[model samples]
Target: MTTVVSTGSYDYLTSALTTMPTPVTTSSTWPQVPRWLTLRQSLRMARDPVGNLNKVLAAYGDTVHLYLGGVKPSIVTRDPALVQHILQKNHRRYHKSDLTHGLLRYLGKGLLTNEGADWLRQRRLIQPGFHRQRLAGLTRLMRAAADEWVAELAALGAAQGPVEVEAHAAMTRVAFRIVARSVFGDSLSDEELMQLSDWLTAIQLFYVTTIRQPYLRPVQHLRGRYRQHDDLARRLRELVRAAIARHRTAQAAAPADAAPPDDLLQMLLDARYEDTGEPMTEHQLIDELNILLVAGHETSANALAWAFFLLARHPEVQDRLAEEINRELPNGQEVEFAGLPRLSYALQVVQEAMRLYPPAWIIDRVATEDDEFQGVAIPKGSVFSLYVYGVHHHAGLWPDAEAFRPERFAADAQPALPTYGYLPFGGGPRLCVGSHFALTELQLVLIQTLRRYRVLPTAETPPGMNPLVTLRPAGELRLRFEQR
Candidate 1:
């Protein structure tokens, strides 16, 4: 039987005890009585998860039981072994949790939110599109986009004194353009890209509020929040429809002898189900595209912004990185797809930055069947949060966890980590399909940006975490760009 622990009793019990509570003993039955958060604590957590999570870590150690009002108790864990068990070892017994289910309103049944057999099928079909060779072919397109952004920054730097820019916003525009060019090819117009970006930002904000604070749902509904979200989603769908129509028209206009352009949109349009040999319907295609647009750009943008922020605060590391980039690609030369491997320091810098500030800060999963780990009973339907941020910062896992040391990720110096300890892209069969894509983009952008300008810290250099749909800067990450 599940015992409901009241917050008042927990506080009394803790206060009454003179010594630290004994560690829970291993047992077939549920091991220890869980400590529940008070209603006030739950509300504060919803508003500031990263801050509260840090507090919980300090108070409860690696694992904690959270009780959100009106919702079932959930477990949050930072233990690498438990994380590995949930994400890799026993992955089949678990599925994407309600946290992702809440995204269905915005993303629909796409790869990011879809579950079970359909998700598996879609993953298999789309996997080929992100293969290394396919991504390699798009290197020139990626470089071209990076070059355009760098040139724009150059113009800004020349026109202004140490041009101040919001790194997150700037990176979002660049990343979105790269995804648009890579995925939809030339089918999307500039206006359409801007509209899609705006809509996505609105939808993300709406999602964060509704999902995090269920208690506020009534208030949000009264404010027509859902209507605003629906309107943005409708406009986005129309944009996708228009792009698809353009692709179809281009295909029709081409001569029979001419081959259609090899792009992500064409790739998806040409893909067929293995068992049924059927293609995705227009709606399905749109959903998949929406997922790509949302997933493809946002995470990369946050990561790039954070990487820049870290580099700005650590100028010595930035100087070393710039030196390496200059040695590899002298005089701001165009980056070749084949030459990416040579930029090892730049790659290390990106990896270390991601370690400190993983964009996908938390991963949630729900068990399909009752299970136990280390004598703790995990009931079926129990929500498990794999706290990526916590694990990355866990003192036991990495020495000097709070310090930003890119050298720690250097090939020769990198330390061994537990299976699930470093999950920037997550793990197991469901590992982010865009991992290689994102890494490549970060490398190119870093190479281009540093080669052109020195990213210096301003008053807002080291930004705080926002912890929304993704971990973004709590506020504007303002930085100065001085032309090198």
Candidate 2:
């Protein structure tokens, strides 16, 4: 259990608490609960890490100082307005927390987990990659990838009995391939691509193991797992360096006005920061590209797996989605981005799934200076973990919070959720740049998939959570695919 102490002036702390806009009054029941939490009871059940937040909030009320280990965990407001104020208005006073810094030893400071000027610069440069116009062109490529996977699943459903979905493996492969194709174009050979994919999967597993075994931090330096991550990083760096060299050589020999290839690598090569009048340095390119490969795939893969799981559990929802997909494509044709919104129900299914099992589940930040949040005084260096799962699942915020109902997102539906209540993509100035890209990919995959087969959970699969950097299915979330 972490214990957190307010080392600052006692009066300052009290004053800050007293100023809360809608402060918890002295007579409120929230303050009576014990600040320090024991590991044996509530903590054990919260093995998924953030799962026990809602329970804690329910018992202790909106603001509770949980002492675990030796750190003070101040679980504050789930209010959206408060969330926006913290993440957006007061963002300058906060940076990525220590937990994110620890994870970056493996992930690097891709836009997903970086802070300061470097993060700002990377976000600015990479934003164009996800621009609506840029993404629309990639739709054909995304559709082709989705179509191939759907065809494979359809074949399996017809030929095999109760085929295992291999949710993680399947989604990971598809997502990784799409990012690779978008970034590197044809620079990587088929064998090289497959090898990189396998290495990435291994590295992802190793990273998860390290994060799960919190004690691994001290001994990680001695473990083969740490070596494994280092080796994978080296290998990935080598591959990117080779690709960059190849691209440079090819570009130098090509005509000055030649049309650039339709790929992310070419786009980066051609791009220049307007203010700096400079292209991304080789090192910057490599780091950001690696970020895309890791960040892009990990979250999307988890979301896809969860969406499938949700659809499997709710067959009526699945059937409705399938009907919409069929109705749109009477001849069972491929879907385009322009027609993607036509699968509104499928989109809702994916959205609802993201709410229940957000891949980027926990958002963290470190206070740069003493800050006041809705009347609460947060000492400088104090870490704030926005429990997104807790917020999404809080009964006060979501009506029938745990139920799988997509219609809640239907037009004119009035659940009256808080501002940050449905932040699957985060919010404010630091909102996810690739949100549109992820949604586009998810919609196409789900629609094409439903058009091909029906999904049912496999008997061996259990509904468990894996909380690493992203939330994922803990075990083999296998499912049977029956051809429609």
Worst 10 residues of 2 by lDDT: 1-10
Clash totals in order:
0, 12
Could you tell me which residue pairs clash in candidate 1?
A: none
Give a tens-digit lDDT track for model 2, residues 25-77.
46422242354353443456347456566555565555555543323454444
State, as a TM-score between 0 and 1, how close model 2 is to the true structure: 0.87
Model 1 TM-score, all chains together: 0.91
Best by lDDT: 1
Stretches of candidate 2 off by over 4 Å are 1-36, 41-46, 68-77, 154-162, 224-228, 250-259, 460-462
What lDDT is reached at residue 270 by model 1?
A: 89
CA shift of 88, model 2, Å: 1.6
